[model samples]
Target chain A: MLGPILETLIGGLLTGVLYSLVALGFVLIFKASGVFNFAQGVMVLFAALSVARLSEFFPMPIAIALAVVVMIALAYAIEFLVLRRLVNQEGIILFMATLGVTYFLEGFGQTVWGSDIYKIDLGMPKNPIFVLESVFPGGLLIDPSELIAALICAIMVVALAIFFQVTRVGRALRAVADDHQAAQSVGIPLNQIWLMVWAVAGIVALVAGMMWGAKLGVQFSLSLVALKALPVLILGGFTSIPGAIVGGLIIGAGEKLAEVVLGPVLIRMFDLAGGGIENWFAYVLALMFLLVRPQGLFGEKIIERV
Target chain B: MLYREAGQFKTSYSADQAIFSIAQDRWFVMIVLLLGFVGVPLVANQYLYTEVFIPVLILSIAAIGLNILTGYCGQVSLGTGGFMAVGAYAAYNLALRIPDMNFILVFALSGVVAMLVGVLFGLPSLRIKGFYLAVATLAAQFFLEWAFARVKWFTNYAPSGSVAVGKIELFGFAIDTPDRKYLFVLALVVVMALAAKNMVRGRLGRSWMAMRDMDIAAEIIGIRPLNAKLSAFAVSSFYIGVAGALWGFLRLGSWEPLAFDINRSFQVLFMIIIGGLGSILGSFLGAAFIILVPIFLNQLPHLLGIPLSTAAVSHIEFMVFGAMIVFFLIVEPNGFARLWAIAKEKLRLWPFPY
Candidate 1:
């Protein structure tokens, strides 16, 4: 009993790392642009697809490098086309524009990289590892790829934290996030900062894509990883990176545990096949949080002005 | 000169307050109605009725529902599909449970059930605003999608989780033929569209607009945010629900939970955005544009003698819509309705060098 429960906990926490990475992209863009970039999910799929396809001819490192260059170009192009043109537009309009971007990317990604599923051949060892065998009769089983992903996420988070703390652009980013017009007054170019943030977000998406693709084959469903991140963003607050990490962990654990514990109970009570209760556990939890605390765990209190 | 509205004056307040105060505008609407009700059905084939008009009309009602909440009330919701699902499943259950129920009555009750669900989900709007509220609506979307998919009772225990509607009849007239279904859907759409028009022009509508413009100011002026927001949600859900029922009954006749997914919600939202958020006619314009554009896109390569796969055409469609949306926002955020209105304004002052 203890072994299975511990394994599930570890499994959930590891899955949460991938979610944190995705949510990090969301927070970065939302902080800089005030636009909830709905296309972030599709961008993940696009990045994964590009890398996977490019790997067919080029080596893995070369494929990843080329994908990075592509992502940077995409970031710049988005800044030039949609973001630059729609300055001072309503947030809702910007959000709608991202939906358009999502559609474009969906088709564009499928068109460029074949629509059929592609295996992201990371070539990671897939054999199960035994831990605490002596302590428990049956040891906890762990997937090597998931453990690697969690480690990469930890290192990335640390690197990002350091970059933000000790860099010039990072200070500029903080200034802009605090107040856009004031940052402009202080000689921080808003457009450049936006471009920088988007580029950083693109990198974040690429990292998230690689890991998720390795776990679930590079396909359209990979885009839906964004759906998992949304509840995280709502719970963690869109501006706080640490909030995202914590939110992801909670949501991941909650959903996984609910699937194990509550799913069967509800299934039996309803006298039906197993309810895919995992699909909505995080969202329902987030909804309850919204009702009680609209600002989220770390979001600043919103002051309405007329 | 063709579109001129000069010398047409309103004689009274009621005349001034009429939907189309301009003689030209009124005449245009009347002619369009005649064309829709009479001209189209006379010449249109089964493909046009079954494939084009029926789905377009049903979806327009759904779009108008979304416009009320998102456009007029300034409350962005991404749960349009979920509310529609509520309507579809409610109608499904109603029709199955009460075999002898009136078709019109079944649709109405479905709308009511959807309205109640909308209000339940809408409780978050009083506390949150903007994107938070948008995300909140998504909870409704996913939960409802899960409910419809997971619960066999919603689909009447169909092993495939797909439900099919029985024959629908109104006053002993079987709604069997494609044209008949088209006419029925059009009539319902027309009534609801008019009703939506009327609702938007009344006190509640004004209150919604006021709240949209500035919620705090609207509240200061004694406009209750809770009342206006919830009503917008309820009414929007009612129309969407009716559309969902119609979609299931008239359009597909059989569909699974996938019919009303997040994609469908986004589609209707895009319709309102591309059409013109605050305009009544914009809903239809948006819906028609969305439904017809892909068909046109599919036919374009064939006409040009270019060999493009269906997937390539769809990709082009996505790129075009993305570019078009950004282009429209940059050119005019008021969308295609305002573009139409602007053309009319230009025509009114044509042959003038300004």
Candidate 2:
């Protein structure tokens, strides 16, 4: 029992890292533009589909490079067509516009790439390795893909942290996030910053899409992963990147544990057909967190003055 | 000149406060209603009723419900689908268990059940603000969806996790036909819409609008946040719930839990946003546009002599919807209803220039 639990915990933490990858894009956009981008998930699907299809005609590395270009192009298009027109709108309206983007991307991706399940082979090992053999009966088995994902996620987060702290563009991005008007007053080009931020978010979506597409196949449902990341966003504040990481880990671990351990107990207690509690478990947990701390675990404290 | 209301006069408070204040406005609405009730039934065939009128009517009610909350009360709820599901399930249970209950009462009771659940989920609104509250509502959506799917009791232990209702008989009239169903739904919608209009026109609606505009300011003006938010949730849920029941019973006839999923919620949200928030008429316009545009898009390949696959058409439909949403948000965030209002304003000053 302990061995399986330990295995699940470690596995969940790795999956949580992947979730954090997706949530990070949301944080980047929210921080820069104050837009709660519902399109991030669809953007992930779109990016993955682009790479998967482009790879059919080109080399893997070139496909990835082209996909990055595609994402940057998307950022420009969104900035020019949607974001430019929607400046100074209410947050909710901006949020709704992102939903529109989500719809368009879903259709556009499918139409351009076709809706079949496309494979994204990153050449990551699929085999599971066992560890702690002496401590556990069958040993704790772990997937190397997940381990690689975790490593990649760690590197990305570090790179992002450095970008935000040690670079001029990053400082500008932070300034824009802090106060749009003040940032503009200080000679920051709001349009350029928005374009840059959206481009960065698009790249993040590309990385996330590659990871998720390799794991789950590039399909329409890849976009639904956005729904999963939303709970993580709530656990970690919308504007905090590190908070996104921590929140993802907690939610991922809690959901897996509940699905594996408490699932059967509830199944027996309620005479349920089967255990799929993880679907709602993360959301309910986030909701509870909202009640206690609406700003999230690491969010800036909200001070409402009438 | 005909559209001008310059000569209209009101001698009493009732006349002044009439829903359609202008005499021309009153006449237009009366004519439209007459056409809807009498003209439509005679001309509309089965396909028209099933594929168009029924759905537009049902969704309009749901849109109105959502408008009441998001537009009027200023509380954005992504859980409208869940609240609708509650109503659908509640009505199903009531109708199934009690064989002799009136269909009208069953619908009302289901709305009430959805209202209670709405109030429960809405408790978080007081603590959470703006986007935070919006995200929190997803909890209700997912949880309710899970319950309806997982709990065998809700589905009456069917091998398949879907529920079906028998023919609805209201006072010896079997409402199994399409036109009959449309008429029943139209009558209910008219009544409910009037009630909704009155509610918004009264103090409750005023308080809701006040709260929506600025909650803190509304609270400072002595409107309790708890009461205002919860009441908005309750009323909105009740309206959405009835629409859900109508959707399940009248529209789909037999369905699964997937019928009222998050997609339905988003669809209704789009209706209100495109229709114009905070306007009852906008709900209907939004519903009509949402329902009709897709149908029209699907047929464009045939009509325009474009040789496109069904898949391609659907994809284009999605792109169009997305582009339209952004277009509307940019050009006119108030939606089609606002456009109509502007047209009316222009008409009121037609053939004359400053």
Candidate 3:
């Protein structure tokens, strides 16, 4: 029993890292622009589609590089076309604009790249390796793809932390996030910073898309991962990077454990057809957490002054 | 000018406080309502009733419901679909179990049931705000959707997990025909829309708007956040729930849980946004636009004699819808109702401009 539970926990944690990768894009865009970017999921799907389809013509490396360029162009286009005109609007309106972007990206990705599921092969090993054989009877089986995803997530987090700490552009980004007017008054170009942040977020979407597409095969449903990341944001706090990571891990693990453990009890109690509690478990957990700490675990404390 | 209201006068408080203060406005509304009730049934075909009018009217109720919460109360919700599902399923079960119950009472009871669910989900609004609140509402959406799908009792243990109703009889009149369904839906929608308009005009509506514009300020002004916010949720869900029942019973006639999915929530949200937030009339206009635009897009290629696959047309429709949303948000965030108001304003001026 312990071995099975431990194995599930480890598997959930690895999956949680992937969620963190997606949540990072949302956090980056939200922190910099104060816009809750609803299009992040579609952006992931779009990036993955771009890479997958482009690889059909070009070498893998060239396809990836082209995909990066495409993402950057998309970043610039969103900033110029959508965000630039809607300055000083309400957060909800900006959020709605992102929804518009989401629909556009979904249509555009499907139109440009045929609406069929495409696979990404990073040449990662397909077999699962067993670890701690002596401790458990059958040992714990782990997917190498998930491990690679975790490694990539870790590297990105470290790189982002260092960039924010040591680079001038990163400092400007932080200052812009703190206060838009004050940051602008101090000679930081708001447009440039927004473009940069969006571009970085686009790159993050690319990496997330690749990882997710490799794991599940690139399809329209890949966009639904955005819904999954939303609970992670609720748990982590919309504007905190580290909060996103921790929140993702907690949500991912909690949902999995609940689905495995509590799902059966509910199924038996209610005579449900099957156990699929993970569908809403993460959200309910985040909602409960929010009731206790509305600001989120690592979110900056909200101070409202009339 | 034809649109001018310069000569209209009110001698009493009731007249001054009337929903339509202008005589011309009153006359126009009367004409429109008369046409809707009497003129439409005379000349309309079955296709128009089934394909166009019924859906528009049903969705308008939902749009109004969402407008009351997200537009007036300033609470963002992504769970309109869930509340709607509650109404649909509630109506289904009530009609199934109590075969002798009046259809009207069944619909009302479904609204009441959905109201309770809405209030329960809305409890989180006190703790969270903005996008967080939106996500919390999504929890309600997913949970309710999942429950309706998983809990066999809700569907009456239908093997296919879908529910259907037999012929609906109200007051010994069989409402089996398309025109009858349209009239039934139209009557309910008109009553509900008027009720919503009145509710929003009164002190209750004021309290909701107060909470929406600024919650802290509204609290300072002696409006209880708990009462104001929960009431908005209750009223909004009540309206949406009835719409859902109408959608399930009158429009679709049969539906699975997918009938009121998250996409439905987004569709209603889009209606309010495109119609004009915080305006009752905007809900109708937005609903009409959202429903009509796709149909128009589907026909555009054919009209132009351009041969395009259905898939391509759908993709283009999506692109156009998305573009239109962004365009509307950028150009006129107030939506079509604002444009209509502007048109009215211009008409009042007529051939003269300052």
Candidate 4:
């Protein structure tokens, strides 16, 4: 029992880190645009599908490199073509546009790569790392790839933090996030800022896609997991990157623990006979969080002026 | 000119405040209802009734329910399918446990069960609003889907995790036939639609609209946010629950939890969005649009004598449908119901510029 618990915790941490990566992309876009891009998950699927197909057809390294470039281009194309035209639309309209984007990308990805799931081999060294046993506390083991994923996430988060805090364009992006009108008053080109932010978000999504694809294989179901990030965004506050990471960890660990511990108990209580709690565990946890703290763990308190 | 309402003059407050005050509008609605309930079953074939009419009617009922919440109350939900599943399963259990239970009573009771679930889930909306609220409701969707799928008793311990109704009857007339099923659905839809139309026009409806417009202001004006929001959830779920019963009992006849998946929720949501968010008439129009468009798209290629695989056709249909959503959002974000109102406004001022 203790062994499985520790193993689950380590696995949960790794999964949480990956979820944080996806959540970060959402935070960046929501912070910048105030539009919750429902398509973020689809973008992950699209990126993974692109990488999987490219690697299949071309040299692995070159395909990975080209896939990154394609994602960046796609990001720029979306910004230029669709989002550019929708600059001043209502928030709901923007949300709907993203839904449209979700559909388009899903159909487009399936069309390009076919709907079959593909095994993605990124040529990472698949050796288990001997980490401190004390950390996990009971012969809990983690794969080297997951540690690498966590490291990558840490680096990405730190890089994003620095980019936002130290860079001029980052400051401009911050300005836009604060107030679109005020940002314009400061002579920040709103359209350019939006395009740049969207591109950055795309990059974040690409990394998330690669990491998740490595774990789950490149498939449409990956997009569904991306939907799980919405609750993370809610819990972490839409505008807070650190909040996203923390929220992801809590949700990830919480879901796994619930499944392993309380799931069977509830199943027995309800006389459900067969235990399967992990399926809705995450959502139920999110819902509980929503009821208690609508602003989320790190979200700013919403003040309505009307 | 045939649609003119020149002599329609309201003399009493009841007449003035009537659902269809305009004589022509009333006549037109009555005719449509008659055609739907009585006429369609007579003239339409089995395929039209089974594949088209019953499905459309059931979806319209669900759309009307969603419209009450999202359209009028301004509480966006992503759990209509979940609530529908609750209703479907509840009805299934009610029918199975009480072998001699009335099918209609079971259907109505299933709606109450859904209402309870909707209210339980709706508790989050009290603190959450807008997109946050939508996410909260999505939790309901996934949770309900999982519960139904995993819980063996919910499916009556079915081996394949699917549920089916035994048979349905109303007063010893077997509703097994397609035309009979269509009539049953059409009758329920008409009754529910009328109830919805009336409800939305009353005090409760006004309160809901006020809350949707501005919750703070509505609160200031003494409308209890808890009451308005929860009632919206309750009533909306009640309607959606009944529709789910019909959908399972009449339309699909057998289904897994996937039948009420998130995709179905989005389909109903898109119907309300594209039809008219706050209009009862829009629900039907939206449901018709959503239901028929794919069918029409699928048939068009075949009708044109083009040879294409169903998969390819479905792909094109998705692309076209997705593009149409963006188009409608851009063209008239208020929805197809607004378009109808605009046309009516124009018709009221025919042959005159100003």
Candidate 5:
């Protein structure tokens, strides 16, 4: 009993860290542009595809570097082509535009990188390591790649925190997130701020893409998985970075643990055909949270100005 | 002079309440319907009826359903595919088990099933709004897709987890051939389109518009947000569900759970985006555009005699389609319906400045 529970918890936490990485990208773009950025998932897939294609002939680091450059160029292109024309449109309209971007990126990514699945050789060891032998007797098994993901996620969070606190551009991003007109009034270039945020979001997406690609192989489904982080965004609060991390961890652990424990028990108990509740468990959790607290765990209270 | 309603006097409410008060507009619809029902069926080959007209008409019905929620009621739902799946599977189950069931009744019941699911998913809307609500609907989308895929009962214990509907019969007539199926779907779509038009033009529609414009303010004006929102969801879902039934039964003939995936939801959404939101005419226009553009793009290379790989052609089509979506949004965010209205407005005063 103890062994199973410990295994589920550790496994959940590691996957949760990756969810946090994806959710962080969502939070960044949502805060900066207030658009919800439906294309974030596609961006991740696009980045992963770029990295996978580049890494075919080049070293991993160089491929990653080129991927980052690709992402930056994408950021600028999006801002110039889509966002510039859509300035001052309704939030939903902008959101729809991002949906358009999603279609464009999906097509672009598949065409450029080829739609066939490619395994990302990140050189990260994926062997299982057993620990807590004294408590569980049989011990709990954990993957090395998951541990690396968790560690890298922690470092990324810290670096982002410092960048927000110590950097001038970060300050400007916050300002723009706060109030677009006010940010522009204070000598911060609005377009440049948007470009910077998108570039950062692109980088975050690249990280998430690499992590998820390494786990699931570089394929079409990667985009869909990134979208699964949406409920995490809503749970953590779209505007709050810390909220995203916490929400990601919570959703990650919640779904994984539930899938491991509750799924089979419920299936057997109720005579269900099979147990696949992981798809909706996190969503239901988020829906429940939204009902009780419409603001989310860390989202600001919505005050409608008449 | 060709399209003017200047001299049309309405001495009674019924005259004023005519669907097309304008003489030319009334004539136009009649001509179109005449062409669809009689002339087209006589001349159109199997390919046009099956490949283009049937699919377009069915999809338009679904687009209209979505327009009610997203365009009219101001609720953005991403679970349209799931709702449609509910309709499809329900119809499938009813048709499979109830050997004596009426085909029309099966379609109606399918709509009801989808409506119930829509309302269930729509429960989140009472608390959440905007993008949050959209994500909640997404939960419904993923969950339903999972349900149909994993649950054996929905698929009637099929080894492959896919269920196909057999030939549908209405009264004494069999709708087996493409032209017959096209006519059947067309009749259903036309009736539903009329129903939708009247619904939007009536009291219930005003309430929906009020709720959409501003829920709190609408509540202040004595409209129950619950009633308004749920009814919109109910009606919208019913249309989509029936459309799904037709799509499965008539168009695809057989479909798996993957048929109504997230991409289907997005496709319908795009139809509304490009066609025109908040307009029934736009729903048809949007569906037509979405269906035709790809077909046209696919045929373009062949027309040019370019020997490109099928995969490469599809990729180029995607690129073009994506670029067009952005271009359309940038050029006219209000969509083709609005553009049509602009053209008509311009035509009323043609050969004159202002």
Candidate 6:
């Protein structure tokens, strides 16, 4: 019993880390542009699909490097062609434009890759580090892949924190986030800042995409992971990085725990075939969080002007 | 000269307050309604009624529901599809379980059920507003979709997770034919559209507009936020629910949960945005524009004597549709309703150098 619980916890933590990575991309864009990019999940799908196709011919490492370069170029193109044109639009218009981007990317990705699921060979070293013995007689076992993913996520978070706090460009990015007009008054080129932020967001999306694809195999369904991040954003607040990370863990673990504890009872009560609450648990939890604190765990309270 | 209203005069306040005070406008509307009710049934073919008119009418009704909430109430929603699903499933159950129940009664009762659900989901609006509320409504979308998909009760434990309705009848007259179905939907559309127009022109509508423009100012003027918000939800859901019932029973005749997916929500929302938020006329225009444009695009190649694959047509359809949305937003951010108003203003001063 203890072993299974521990294993579930580990699995939940790894999945939560990936969600946090996606959430980071969302926050980066929202903070800088004040527009929620509904297409962020599609960006992940595009990156994963691009990498999978590229790796069909090139060696693994070379394919990955090429994919990175392509993603960066794609980032620049999106900024130059789309976001730049949408500058000074209302937040809702910008949001809808990203929705258009979502549709365009989905169709374009499917047309290019042909709607078939592709296996992603990231070539990461996959081995169990150790087996854990439960305090109970029958012990649970944990996988090293889950631990590795979590560790990688932690390192990435630290690096991002350090970059934002220490680097000059990061300072400029923060300035732009703080107040776009004030940052402009300080001679920061707003368009350049937007391009930089989008690039950074695209890179984070690539990392998230690769990690998630390595787990689930590259497919359109991977975009549903964005649904998980929606609740995470609501729980952690839209603008808080730390909130996103913590919120992801809470939601991921909460879903798993609900499945373990209440899945059977509810299944019997509802006379359902599937006895797991994993699908609806996260949404229900997030709805409760919204009711309790709409600002979320770490979001700033909004002040409406008359 | 026949279209001109030069001799029309309002002698009383009630006459001036009539829905169509101008003689020309009144006569034009009567003619259109007459053509819809009496003319279309006689001349329209089955394919036109089933494939084009029925679907467009149902969608226009749904668009009107969304326009009430998102346009007049100023609350952006992404759960229109979910609420529609609730109405549909509820109507399905009501029509099926109650052996002697009339189909029209089922439709009306299903709308009431949808209203309850709408108010339940709308409770979040008391605390959240704007984009936050939009995100909150997504929970409703996913939850309802999951419920319909996973819960066998919704499908009445059918072998497949799909529901179907038998032929509908009213007053011992079978409504199985396309002409009869078209007339049925047309009648509902006229009744509901008039009801919506009247509702929006009333005091309740003013409160909603006030809240939409500025909630704080509305509160300062003594309008309770809770009342204004929840009533908007109820009324909006009521219309959407009826539309859903009609969509299921009259139009599709059979459907899976996929009929009311998130994409449906976005489509209805886009209709409201493009059609003009607060106007009933805008809903019809928006729905017609969205529904007809795709059909026209699909048929264009055939009309032009070019053979194109359906896949290619669909792809081009998507691209052109997306581009058109951006173009319309750029050109007239207020939507087609605003354009209609502008035209009306011009008509009020025609043939003169003001």
Candidate 3 off by > 4 Å: none
Per-residue accuracy of model 3 over A158-206 as CA lDDT, tens digit each: 9999998799999999999999999999999999999999999999999
Provide C-alpha RMSD values for all models, in order: 1.6, 1.0, 1.0, 2.0, 1.5, 2.4
Candidate 4 DockQ, CA atoms:
0.57
RMSD of 2: 1.0
lDDT of 5 by residue, B1-354 (tens): 566667889899998898888788889999999999999889999999888999899999999999999999999989989988999999999899899789999999999999988888888899999888998888999889988887778888888887877878889799898888988888999999999999999999999999999898899989999999999999999999999888889988888989999989999999998888899999999999999999999999999999989988887888888888888999999999999999889877775737
- For model 1, chain A alone compared with the true chain A gives a TM-score of 0.97
True interface contacts reproduced, per candidate: 0.71, 0.71, 0.70, 0.50, 0.54, 0.24
Instruction: State the displacement of the C-alpha of residue B273, model 3, in Å, after optimal TM-score superposition.
Output: 0.4
Question: Model 4: per-residue lDDT, tens digit, B1-354?
Answer: 545668777789999888888877888888987877778767899888777888888999999999999999999999999999999999999998998788889989999999999999998888889888888888889889988988788998999999888878777888899988877877788789989989999999999999999999999999999999999999999999988888888888899999999999989998988888899999999999999988898899999999987777776777777777777876788888888988887777675635
> Isolated chain A: TM-score per model?
0.97, 0.99, 0.99, 0.93, 0.98, 0.93
Docking class for candidate 4:
medium
True contacts kept of 3: 0.70
Best by DockQ: 3
Cα lDDT of model 2 by residue, A57-99, tens digit: 9999999999999999999999999999988888888888999
Candidate 4 on A1-306: residue-level lDDT in tens? 677776778778888888889999889988988988888998889888888889888987788788778877887877876777676776766787788778777777787787888878866778775556765454456787888888999999999999999999999999999999999997999888887887788888888888889888988899987777877778888889999999888878877888788988887787674666666676777778777888888888889967
Model 5 backbone overlap count: 0
Better of 3 and 6 by TM-score: 3
Q: What is the lDDT for A195 in model 1? A: 95
- A54-141 per-residue lDDT for model 5 (tens digits): 9998999999999999999999999999999998877777887888888788878888889999988899997898888887788889
TM-score (chain A) of candidate 6? 0.93
- Model 2: CA > 4 A from native: none
Model 5 fnat value:
0.54
TM-score of chain B of each: 0.96, 0.98, 0.98, 0.97, 0.98, 0.96
Steric clash pairs (candidate 3): none
Evaluate all candidate structures by whole-model CA lDDT and list the values in order. Answer: 0.90, 0.92, 0.94, 0.86, 0.90, 0.83
TM-score of each: 0.97, 0.99, 0.99, 0.96, 0.97, 0.94
What DockQ does each candidate score versus the true complex, computed on alpha carbons?
0.71, 0.78, 0.82, 0.57, 0.64, 0.41
